[model samples]
Each structure stands twice: as structure tokens, then as C-alpha cells.
Target: MISQDVGTRAISVQNVTKQFGFFNALSNISLDVAPGRFVSLLGPSGCGKTTLMRIIAGLDRQSTGRVVIAGKDLSLTPPHRRPVGLVFQRYALFPHMTVSQNVGFALSLQRVEKKKAANRIGELLEMVQLSAFADRPIDQLSGGQAQRVALARALAAGPPVLLLDEPMSALDLKLRQAMQLELRQLQRSIGATFLFVTHDQDEAMVMSDEIVLMNSGTIVQRGSPEEVYRQPRTLFSAKFLGEANIFTGSLRREGNKSLLQSDVVNVRFDVLGARDTGAGLVCVRPESITIEGASKEMFVGTEPNSVAGQVREAIFQGAFRRYLVQVGEQSIMVQQPVLAGTGDAFSQGDQVLLKWSDQAVAQIEDDTNG
Candidate 1:
């Protein structure tokens, strides 16, 4: 029964729930996609991201609630009748059809004039940089070329919204990274609202204007990539979004700053409004930790945010050095940049101190703990 009559919405999903018998696939999902914005539905497998995307495309019906598109209630609308284009993981281009025919498939179905369709197809092929291969059969193109053809076909009709489901998963690593940049640039140039679905965190962070992270049939969190990454609201959001070093401890307040008291080490985590006593969790990102050789005057019990640990392993990555340190029962990871010819990298069995500002770590809210 939830609805949004605020700004113009390209896609409005209101209190939509989907169930297969007793198993709920999506529970009370409600989301708004503004017109001509690129948003991504990101989550792990079986997180209902795909199911929700299908509901928006009219391929699956919700058990309850409504869907409105561009001021029209399209809950009962069929898939082909909706003004949305779709692209799948596989290219799904016709084996017997040439690039031109495949790109112009929707246009031909609408019975647009022959010369006009060819001209429009030519423009799309040029846009995707596949004009040279327009006359070639689908079987003759490379994997990247085939993907470009599929993208051009989806954009051929100029649909107001485009739904993509892991469209770059099939490509190799280098190609996938390249396509990520290209697709983001293409979305900006064409000005079409894109609702993308993917499991890769890097891909979602790179291209999305806003990311909707779903978990176990519910929306866990939704915000810009930096907001969700830097200030995670929940423990699940902190761990699932990126690599996190978790600390289970107690929370206390000291004047303007909050402190996370743990058995391993105590740090000043500036959290707010929670009880000053109880078990809690503190999350520190790997890149935020700074590792240095421990001096004689190391941190005592009263240091603000510092700890001493023994280096268990140190690996040399190209641009940075990765160190694994053991402090009591916790394993801390620190990534330090390799300055040119400094030779200051630590090795195994070396004692190091972990130091970071209070702004680097956060106290995560844990509602799952009973």
C-alpha cells in the first residue's frame, strides 16, 4: 500500500511482495527510480535482486501491491507492452540474424518504414562502434562484439528504462573492467534510466549513481557507494559491501567521543545514541589501517587508538604491500602503499604497531545479536 507521488518516477515499486507458496522471495519491497538516472540493484546470489528486476519488467507478478511507470499503473501490463528494454547475461542474439537484423528486430516488429528503420539501425550500430560489423552474422563476432550488438539492440527502441541482469559477467576480467567504464559512459551520453543488477561489488561501485543492496528477500541498505562504504548502518551492510576487520566489544561514551571497549584492544569510535554498556562490534577497513615498525615506547593501555601486533605474513602487491598481523585472537590486515624505493616494507616475524585516526573505524549497529 506504500506509494510515492513526489517527483517524477520512471519506476515506482510499492510494497511489492513475491512468494512461491510459503517461501517469500521478496518481502515488502518498495523502491523509487528517478527518471534518467542509473541505479544498480546489488546483492549476493538468491538475494532477490533478480526477482525484483523481473517484477519491474513485467516478467513476474508480485503477490501483492502495485507498480507504476511514468504516471501509469502498469501492474497488469504485459512484458512486450511495457516501455522497457531488457538485456540478459548471455548475449541472446539470433544465430541466423546479422547484427543489423538483430538491432532492428523491435523496429521491424513495430512495422516502422523500411528506409527509416535502416537509417535508425545504422545510427545505433555507429553508436555502439559496431557499424563495420553490421552486415556480419552473429556467429562471426567476438564475445565483446556480440555484447555490443546486444546492447545496441536493447537501446534501438529508445525505451525510457533499460533493465540489465549481469550483462558483463560472461566477459574476461580485463574486458569486464573495460566494459564497466564504457557502459557508464554510454548511460551518461544516452540519458536513459538504467536499472542494473549484479553481484560484483566493484562493478556496482564503479557505475551506479545509487545502489540498492538487498539481502534475503529484503532491502538491507540503499545509498551512494561512498555513503554505504564509509558509514555502514548495520553489521551485514558493513561485511557484505566490502572487506572488513570486525571487532566484537563493548561501547562507552567519553564527552564528545564514543569508545569501543574490547578484550583485544580499545579504540575511540565516535558512535552516537547507543547504550554506553554492552557487547558491540567495531569495523575497520583494511586500507584505513597504517602499519609501522614498533618503537621502544609502544602504546600502553591508555592509548587512544593504537595496538601492537606481530606480523604473521607480508605479501608484496604491485602498488601496495599487504601485511597480516596477529593481535590476541584477532587477525588484522593493513595495506600500505609502496613508495618509490623506500624499502620500508616489513617482513614475517616483525613486530609492528597498528595506528589509525578515530575517523577511520566505525562502531557498527548489531541488531542480530541476542
Candidate 2:
């Protein structure tokens, strides 16, 4: 069992629901983010990720449920009263204020002493590596610099939990990647719990300790990046996380082996006992399927699992070659290292063998909800 710390609960959402007219933005969502842990709510648009974040920050109230932060029930806490810091996607810094003044804005609002606020501003600037730009106006800073200033301003109030709502989405690809690492390091240095929301799967996988995947006003799955990638509990999760080829097939058991019978292919595999129960969908990552050499094919028997495919298109992708192959009526994608083998250079119609390990196939539920 996972034990909760006795001191405080960082953030808890119990049976939360939110609606807008006839549309349900969020439906009975419950999640707990551990103290000092980085958790990300990840999903596509209209999945209610932003709605949940707004509720936590007190920017929007839930129709029904409880929000507890640091062991305090936030029933009446407004946005300003809650011990939370929010950094928005558009750096919302004051144009008229200098970097130092912006960072000290929260302290000034609370009637903190001038000398103490100055020291706090200096500390925050140093923390976000913006100490040298303290005197510069907000308009003069670059996108990354502006984001750092916004972060500094958010932390000025010494909030225990920080909420980032697509904070790096405005930057370019390279800058966004760099900022993800920097933000993760900053979170560790500050020792504060971070609840981040983003639609980018790569961003969530790169920065989060745990990820909550939502779709259609419900949470599809939640787990570590590796766990979700390796053994996805649902077909939606498997397809959403990365490239996967999903095939529906009937299952039959004989002795200790399981056979998946499809319309175009019949593959025999060995799975844990549950897979042998009935029909299900099989998910295979493109990288897991391989092209065999002439010598390798001699040792292995050609039957159910192995299928003949014709290369429909081959695109060179610098690091790898992506091949779109047609096997009967189904199209399967396979990727290989650019520098590997040359027995039969495949063209638009060249026949190739598609082989995969039985262990690579994962059984997912065939229901629409998955």
C-alpha cells in the first residue's frame, strides 16, 4: 500500500465535476498529487485538462467536489487567498514594470516591507538565472527570458504548489525542449509540488514524474512514462502515447500457447493466462517488428505469425527509414535504421517478410471506451 504523509496532503481532487450549460467539462474526476512531486495532466483539446487546472487554482469553481491543499479544505478560498502560484502560457508580466518590480509584485500586494521585498526579488531572480537582467524592462526580454521572469513572479509569494498551464507552448520546438529541462530543475531546487497541464505527449513524458491522461471528460489512464509506453492498459492510450499498429483477432488456447486469429493473419503467441480467454486486439510498435535475413529465415518456420508484405512506400528519415507496407488488405508501418542490411532493396512492389516477437504484442480491450 502507498502511505500518505501525515503532515499534509499536497493537492487532492475528490469526485470533482464541472459543467458549462449542457456541456460537461469535467466529470467526477479524482486525483492526488504527492507533495514535492511533478505531475502532469495530459490530453488533447476539449479533454477538460485546462478546466481541472483552473479549478485547482481557484480561477474556476467546480460544480461539486472537494479540493484540499496542504491538508486544508479549500471550500471558500479565492484565487488570491489560496497558497498557489500560476504561470500562464502567455507570460502575463506587466509591461511597465522592470524584472525586479515584477517579481516583487506579489510581496508588494501583501504589504511586505520594502527592504524584505527587495531581498526576495533578488533571491528569485538569482533562482531563475535572471539576476543580470533584473533592471531590464519586460518588453526587452526574449521569449525564454520572459518565461523565466514570469516564473520568478509566481514564486515571489512563496506558494507551496505551482501550477503551469501550457507555460512553454508559446516557444519554438528547440526552446520548449530546453525550457522543459530547466523548469524541471527549478522545481527540484524550490522543493515545491508542480501540477502541469499540456496537450503534448512528448512534453509530459519528458518532464513528469507521473502522467494523467484524459479524454472526453474522463481519465483514460495514469502511470509513469515507461509503464504507459510499455504496457498500456487501453488501446486509446497505446495509440495516443506513440506509433502502434492495432489489430483485432480471435483468441484460442492449446496447452500453454495462445493463438490470435485475424482475417489476414493468424499469429501464435504466448501470453499470461488472461490473453487466452477470448478475442482481443493486439498492439505492436513499429520498431518491434523486424525484417529477417536469408540465413535467419532458414532456422525459423514460416506459418501464422510471419506474413508476406509489399513495400508501398519508403521514406528516408535521416536516422531511420520508414516503410509503409501492404499486407493483404491491411497496411503496416515498419521502421529500420538507415545504415542496416541490403539483401533485397525494397521498391514499391517488392515482397518482404514481417516478423515480430510474440512478447512484443500487447492485448488491449476491443471496446470503444478503450
The residue-by-residue lDDT of candidate 1 on 1-370, one tens digit each, is: 3244723799998899999999999999999999888899999999999999999999999999788877688898999999899999997999999999999999999999999999999999998889999899999998888989999999988899999999999899999999999899999999999999999999999999999999889998899999888877788888888888887777778887878777778878665564556777878888899887886456434576789888999999899888999887789888888898776789898888898888887777774554
Clashes of each: 0, 0
Relative to the true structure, how large is the alpha-carbon lDDT of every model?
0.87, 0.85
Candidate with top TM-score is: 1
Q: What's model 2's overall lDDT?
A: 0.85
Best by lDDT: 1
Q: After superposition, how far is residue 365 of candidate 2 from its true place, in Å?
A: 2.0
Flag clash pairs in model 2.
none
Q: Considering only N, C-alpha and C atoms within 3 Å, which residue pairs clash in candidate 1? A: none
- For residue 30, model 1's alpha carbon misses the true position, in angstroms, by 0.6
